[model samples]
Target: MTAEVPTTPPGDAAATREASERGGLPGAVDPPAGGGEAHAASDSALARVVREESGRIVAALTASLGNLDLAEESVAEAVEEALREWRVRGIPPRPGAWLTQAARHNALDRMRRDRRYREKLALLAGATVPTAGEVDERLPLIFGCCHPALSPDAQLALTLRAVCGLTTAQIARATLASATAVGQRIVRAKRKIGAAGIPIRIPEGDDRADRLDLVLTVVSVMYSEAHLVAGRDAAADRDLADDALWLSGVVAAALPREAEAHGLHALLLFHRAREGARAVDGELVLLGDQDRGRWDAALLSEAHRTLESAARLRRSGRWQLHAAIAACHADASSSAATDWLQVLTLYDMLLRYDRSPVVRLNRAVALAAVEGPVEALAEVDSLESALAGYHLWHAVRAHLLRLLGRDAEATAADLRALDLTDNQAERRLIVARLAR
Candidate 1:
């Protein structure tokens, strides 16, 4: 959903400037090499549940035990155990419940030795297994992690680790920081959260107001990461798009009065509506070429209604503007029917909230649609210094150059994009472009 038209960028150590400019999301891990390693990580239900449910399991444990580190550590232990046990025994009927129970037991075992966590163990006793009545605390965990007491980088790192289950190395690569720095950020963040006695629950009143955008940003980053990984079908270890949609919906429901929350939901839905049509038989389908009929009409209708609801609140934010832009594309009868002018205007407004080159690069796409490739080329070229390492930047540049009949330059740009991209689908598309 991200980076195809303008598409999402994959961040790494080389992405120093753009990493800060874009949200911190690592490139997808390449598929495992062979045999048991592949089966454990990919070819099993154990892998699916761990990918989808680990964050919520960790969040629920953190809420029950009131210890972030222990909850996360215990969940990790439970997953390791699952990797070993689930293969021999097969997946349990209720994987989340099973995981929650296993993680709780792991926590109790660890806490029994700690002695200091006796109170926590005592508190954990009543809810040993997950029940239907047990509330999902992932939304709360997300808000609590984004608390303003932590620095912005620390906040991003902590949320990605706790809520998204990203490794410190992955977060560091995306943020262009050392693994040590990311480790320090997470350590200090946990300490600050514990010292300040931050509750494992959603903030209320003005506190929610201050952190809502940050929370949505974190959620969007999660979806972006999911979208990127989903594109790499060979390495598709997790189908996090459903989880991301559910989390965004939960956050939006939890804070109904917040326009941006609904806006974020609408933005995601607009993308989801067309997701099924994104690829066909292992080849990436460009937006223009994809069958419009394949887009989910129900989801598109709901996204419009949601966007309209957001408008009625009269509280405009960047997310709302983004939804409006997405709406423009969704409403078009065909790619040629897309309202590039209104889309460009929305990007204009988006600049007020974020002037990052990623946004500018996306805006250049609309610029090409409305003003022709020459103007868009200049715009894309301006962002070269900041986004040279990002594959989509060159991909977009190649598109514009090819449009302007600069074949040699376009070939060179496509080759550069091929070098930078790790996603198999995008790489194939670039290879196709070069062949043309």
Candidate 2:
């Protein structure tokens, strides 16, 4: 099952409603008008252009305007205008340049009406549109979004919106928050940035290391959300993962000495290598059951080289540790040949940095592979209260129970997992297990 790289994952019912309420997120920006296959092709091209170019354009604008809200609003307006204008004018030879100029003009127009930004208007009037090479301006914008002053939730929301170009609804889905809550956080965050006079400039020296950690965390979350999609629009969902990879690569390039950035890129690439085998014929394939032959050899090789580079740096961050765990699987010729002991060790290291219940749950899975179901079951039982509503916990417990010959309890656990999950593929897998 070859995966289609998506620009945005298809939203749930709530995201759909929010899109309807707000005319649509910038991601859902109207496509070129008209009908027929030709028009459809044009619409897809426009969306691709907008998704690929908008972040850099917005980042460059924010770097100059020193305002996240203004830059995003201006770029969004310009993209919307492009949907209408580009359809008639045909896409410019240099779409990024054209959009930057248009977005700058829009910012200038708005700034002129408000004397509060008279100084900004003067700066923008002379600001040159960033060339292709200058689009890495996202690094500064990322720092601004991940500012320590904001709450972690606010920081994550702002990064996804301002730097990653995810919509409020997309963020809401990813963070498991309501669209209203996510939207409010983004609004409040932008307001705080303005009030606090936060500037979007990349940190230097020691400051760079501290802030890059925050940036990497946000990118990791974005990548995790993008990595697994069962039944959603494959093309749209794939793009979110692609963007995460792109952003992580940019960070690694910008900070060659940062082990965490390289580790993250390696970690994501390792997982992405297996994406092709995650689903088969539109059905979810369990990791152990996936066809290893389908995995991307090129990505696995890159991940190996990247992980080695990060390890050479001698600073083993959480991402690097996680990448090591992924390596245990990637290096295996088959599931039966997997080095479960090595995987278990890496999880131990990961727990030292991140003691979240989710990590513990994952560690329990590795424990089952090494020590037997009884020991792992004990660990899963301890997390019962914490992961009660988390479908995977129940699913893991069910697997353990089945292995232990506790058929009745296994059935009940599977039922609980089925009840808790929204993923159709997961539900189907559980139901099939029950049927068996």
Candidate 3:
């Protein structure tokens, strides 16, 4: 029997709702039939199906179009064609090969239409057509789209659009931004790439290492965002988390010597294990409150194995320490049994490596666990100036203050956090905590 193909449409409320139900992993949610549901399925399939055959699709399109911009456009057009054609004919047996051919044809037609495209067309026409196995060559495209030259936000947006096949609206929703804003960012990034004549080839040596850091950062951000809302969204739409892991794993596989790459992969794996127990009955469950048994044991074991390997390398990077800290929590049978002192030590090491306001905020949480709320409150106060607009800073402060019997201050801080955060779920959690 043939394996069933999973698909979902972009921006369909029901599709998004279903995707959310599946933990936000794209292509995991089945598209509803007709009434625009099929289209939603197609959209979801377009964004995520590429993952299954990413190497073949990317290699073929890149080889055909020469230019990354044109190649991306052709690929998107091909996916659209599939949506229209597949509804009646049904999905082909060799979908990736079909997409590759369709995209190639689309690019050839575009080149034929452009008067100034002769040189590029000739270059593409002379190039050997890529086979499915050659899709690994497109890994360079991933690095190029997520180049360090671009802003972190732009790198992520471009990577999702070019590498992951996400629509601007989907990208915006994933990042909690307006679609128009994401669209503008993508346009600007593409324009910059064009104007700068940025080569699509992957970097080498030191330059490659630098670019890899940026790529890993983008992936880390996506994983963190997905983890934050794991309970709120369906499992299938949880692609952000999986995409992050996939990209990080790719980087780790490609650059085995890079300790940071391994560190990042371990960090994501560790966090993902806790995703299952993050919420109960649609309400957010604090780490302290979550049942340990609810956590995915296989994922947790994988995370520990990765963390152990990362530790054996003996490179004390931020991600490594973070993963170690997460592993400590994973080892505990209950929240009260957590080794807060060890967690605090890891946080100290992490702070030494990177002293961002965000890291400091997390350290404060650990401090609260180990040194008491009063000490944690002091640590938080130190971060107030730097993290003035950050909601979590205020939220942490409120929690600490409330524990210290300062109800008035706790209420005020909670209100400030509510005003600052845009996430409805997070805001709701903060409000409920304040009410308590």
Which candidate, 1 or 3, has the higher lDDT?
Answer: 1
TM per candidate: 0.86, 0.86, 0.77
Report lDDT per candidate.
Answer: 0.75, 0.75, 0.66
| Tens-place lDDT digits, model 1, residues 332-406 | 998889898999999999999888788899999998888998999999999999888777888899889889888
What TM-score does prediction 1 earn?
0.86
Worst 10 residues of 2 by lDDT: 1-10
Error of 3 at 377 (Å): 3.2
Question: By how many angstroms RMSD does model 3 differ from the true structure?
Answer: 7.3
What does candidate 2's lDDT look like per residue over 291-354, in tens digits?
9999999999999999998988999878888788888888899888999999898888888887
Ranking by lDDT: 2, 1, 3
Q: Estimate the TM-score for candidate 3.
A: 0.77
What are the root-mean-square deviations of the candidates from the true structure over C-alphas?
5.8, 4.6, 7.3
- For model 1, the stretches where C-alpha displacement exceeds 4 angstroms are 1-43, 128-135, 167-184, 234-238
- Residue 281 in candidate 1 has what lDDT? 73
The TM-score measured for candidate 2 stands at 0.86
